[model samples]
Target: MKQLVIAEKPSVASDLARVLHAKEKKKHYYEGKSTIVTWGYGHLLTLKMPEDYKKEWKTWSMDTLPMLPKQFLIQPLPKTKGQLQAIRQLCQRKDIKEVVIATDAGREGELVARWILQYVRYKGPVKRLWISSQTDKAIKEGFAHLKPAKMYDDLFYSAQARSEADWLIGLNVSRALTIQYGDQLSAGRVQTPTLALVRKREKEIESFRPKEQFTVELSYQGHPLTSRKPLVFSKKETAEKVKAQLQKETAVVKEKKVKVKKQWAPLLYDLTELQQVANQRYGFSAKKTLNLVQSLYEHHKIVSYPRTDSKYLPTDLESSMKERLQAVAKEFSLSGTILQKGKVQQRKVFNDQKVSDHYGLIPTEVAPNISRLSQDEWKIYQLITKRFLNLFYPPYEAEEQTFVILLGDQNFQLKQEKVLEQGWKEKEEGVSSLHLSLNQELPIQIKVVSSMTKPKSRLTEGQLLAQMEKHHLGTPATRAEIIEKLVNIQYLERQGREFIVTPKGKQLLTLVNESLVRPELTEEWELHLQKIEKGKEKKEQFIQKMKKEATRLVTEIKQSEKEYKDFALTTKKCPECSGRLREKKTKQGVFYVCSNPECHYKRRKDLKVSNHRCPQCHKKMVIVEGEKGAYFKCQSCSLTEKIPDKKAKKQKMTKQEERRLMKKYSEKAPAENPFASALENFQVQD
Candidate 1:
């Protein structure tokens, strides 16, 4: 009997099929003599929505604030229903005696496969194919030594707990706030706290008061020497006095200290670090960087798993270091040198206990074709390759020197750094030059500088990701998505490289309970989830605690005296309900919605005047938002044209020329046209 293998994504399933020799590709499954491979499109199922449980839960009301389900259910995603059905049929095939779960080797991956199995009621014997990369060698080895599906039960439990907890807390709180405030506002266990962090930083920036201070500096030779302790005098007179006294005296060298330090290379890229670096260097948002790296890992098959949190490799992977190094040696000179050396130094990067689901992101045995990669993909691949190559290189060596000089009653200090060896930083090291000798006294020049204290800079995407990592807000895989969600929901705005909290976001935070806006709650939940994964904690206990917390949060919010103001009002009136339209921000940009609670009128705020002129009116057509989709409408003759699914072909006209033509046509038009009489009658009515 043949075995059925299910992978997480089509790309991965194709890779598995190629390696397993399942060449005959059917509609949804690939068949071979011994096996059949099918795939899911990421997640085929998700936790059931509140409305899915019962009809009463459909309405947003305070009475149904805490809609806790005794048993959470899974529903097939609308877009993937066909794929799920195909998998079910494949699983129930009589010839398929055993099923293989070949999804990603992670918690969410386990949940993806298990939920399908539970829904399909698959009772066949099961095995799991766990591998880090999609390389042919790794796939072959992984299939040869497939593990039992029972081993990942705890992981599945943890995944389910996380999904259900988010649903309970996020949906319940969102409904409670929306009902209380008469606007659609959302709050989540992780997203709310992250928003609070940004708002907190903004508050700090707003309340910051700058104070002017003065400091004296002495120029010895060409180097400026400042006080060892930064002496910021509040009074400029005091600094002037010190500078004047120091200018009359000659400086004497008091002491000199020198130390040689070796700076080791940075650890390998976990998803967070990689996102951080990419944001800082290329101005790529966290989501953009994640997408780029994910493409490199999945589509190019060049990098290892991109969603790993561990920055260390498993000890067993050390056996393939030579092969990995050889793969990149053609592109990187450091790789060639390392291969020539024939000995990789054992560093902190190789730790068995530290590795959880996958090792650090690295290059696989498949050599990358640089010409085939996009610009962003090439840059990210280079980053990973450089980090991996740096592992085998020596540490950066530098001579750090500190000089102390006595001038009057004050002591001045100067530090200089000299690079003795470039080491791993050969291409990136900066140049430094300083001439100093011990026991040399030189003439001194003094200057007093005044400056004002500056507030802390706003958090960049990179800095925010680092903060999220530090606070354990979300996993590496989810942090980028969380940041994008915040931006989409109008809680955070990206101005250049910094994240600024919106006024609406601040109001939302003020209304939410304090516990819900703090990272401690999320961090505590993460700790419990980790314990659950390790079989040290029960999933039921975690759910029970979350239910109580959710109840308390709802009660606190309902009882609070806080008020929410409608700050997003727009001048446009809703065409359907004649209600006042309010501006709303989403991930896809801004839109306008009706203020009436029951009204479902909404439209995109962006409107473009298309070049396609109305046939009857002979006027420029404007793209108007409609119930179905966008359509071209003429304001003069009321003529409408349906926009094509593809790009509409039209003649280009300058705005000035169009405006002139519009004026010319409106002032003097052909009276013989049938629409002209209607237009004249409409104008007379106006």
Candidate 2:
């Protein structure tokens, strides 16, 4: 009898097959002397929808507001049904003696494999191969020590509980809001609270009032020194008076204090921290950062897992510290600086207790193709590599000098900081990190700086991520998607790095049940989910609480007296429902949606790409309708082309022009068609 192995994706299955010596490849499975390897396309199965349980639940009505099933059912996803059938056929092969689950080692990954197992009713000897990082060495070690499949039952249960709760709460609330408001609106467990954070920041910005404020700056030994105390004046006249008095007077040094400080480098990059840092530095979206790092892990096999929440490595991982360092040292050229130091200090960053599903993002023994990597990918990889090197280096040291100075009647305070040692911070070696100066009060320079009290800035993706992690809104792997969903649905938009709540987003928070808007309720459910994972609580109990919440939310919506006014109401009417159309705006373009809930009518904005090229820049133009009819306009060069009409006078070209056109068109003359055509005869303006 042979052993059958299942992996999450085809690439992973190929990796497993290569190592298992399964060389013969069939359409679906790899065949070898005693092993077979098959794969899934992410997830082959998903929980069924409401109508799957009962036909009456298909329509959007208040009677079926809460369509809770006694027991949720699993159905094969339509797109991957063929793959599911293929895996099922392999499970029953007579030669297969035992099965191994080689899916990703996480809560959702466990669910992906377990659901298929339940669907096919695979009742045989089962084992699991779990490992972090996709390196060949890690795969070999993981297979050599496969664990029992039953050991991860709790993880599957937790994942299923989370999924079911979302369906119950999100579907019911979204349906209720859509029905009550008579517009297409959405709400959810994690997304609802996350949207509320954006609205909260937006409200603060809207209500803020800015006023002129003034502060005095003084020059001490040519370096500008600001007062440490609250010396800000509400009036410009008051600040000017202080500045004028301090210009001619010299300050008296009342006290001098000095202290040496040691600062350690930041901890390693968890997925959230890495996303935040990338967004702040390179303006990378959370999803973009995740994708770049994921490619570095699975495609290049250079970094460890990217979805980890832990910033510390496991104690056992400390043994391979040198190999990881050497892998990254190839591109960074810091081997001498890192090697001359002693062995890894093995400080707080190397604790088993702090490590989660996987250790912190770090390099592997496999060297990355530095030259082949895209610029964005290199930026992400560089961040991970340098962070790992910080573990072996020493702490940064600096000295601080602070003193009090008396300037006439007003007391002023000044301070200076200078680096004493550039220990792990090699990036700061050439820059001005060290500059010491003695305190003196010989000369004085004063300038009054006037500024306005500004409102708090909008929330950026990084700030929202930190808020999500703090409130337990979503896990490290799902937070990026949660943010992206709001933007996709037009609830939020991005301006640079800041998040701006759209008009629709503000109404969404106002229309949802009050409890759903607060993060505390979702945080409580997350805690319950954790308890379920540890076997302290049952998945069924947590799900029952969710059902009750869903029912209550639906009932509240049905009875609420609040009315919704469409901020997007347009004069144009929807042809299907005859209701006033609401003009909705999104990143894609403007859209007109019917205000009637039962009407599923939507028209995309009337703008289309055209094959016509701009005469100046040779770039494709857009087709837009104007008062004079349809015309072609180029976005690149701001050139306009009046679309030819049947009434326009026509001219014919010579045989030479026609022959030239044929060759030019065949040679890919431009991104679109050139101004002159090769056609035997074509229309042209007189």
lDDT of 1 by residue, 375-490 (tens): 99999999998888888877889898888887767778877788888777865544446666767776877788899999999999999888888888988888999999988888
TM-score for candidate 2, residues paired by index: 0.86
lDDT of 1: 0.87
Give the per-residue lDDT digits (tens) of candidate 2, residues 142-258. 989999988888888999999999999999999889878877899999999999988888889999999999988776665655565765899989998877877767677766678
What lDDT score is found at residue 99 in candidate 2? 91
Model 2 residue 409 CA deviation (Å) reads 6.5
On TM-score, the candidate that comes out on top is 1
TM-score per candidate, chains pooled: 0.88, 0.86
Q: What is each predicted model's overall lDDT from 0 to 1?
A: 0.87, 0.85
10 residues in a row with least lDDT, candidate 2: 429-438
Superposed by TM-score, candidate 2 places the C-alpha of residue 158 at a distance from the truth, in angstroms, of: 1.1
Model 2: how far residue 124 lies from native, Å: 1.6
Clash total of candidate 2: 0
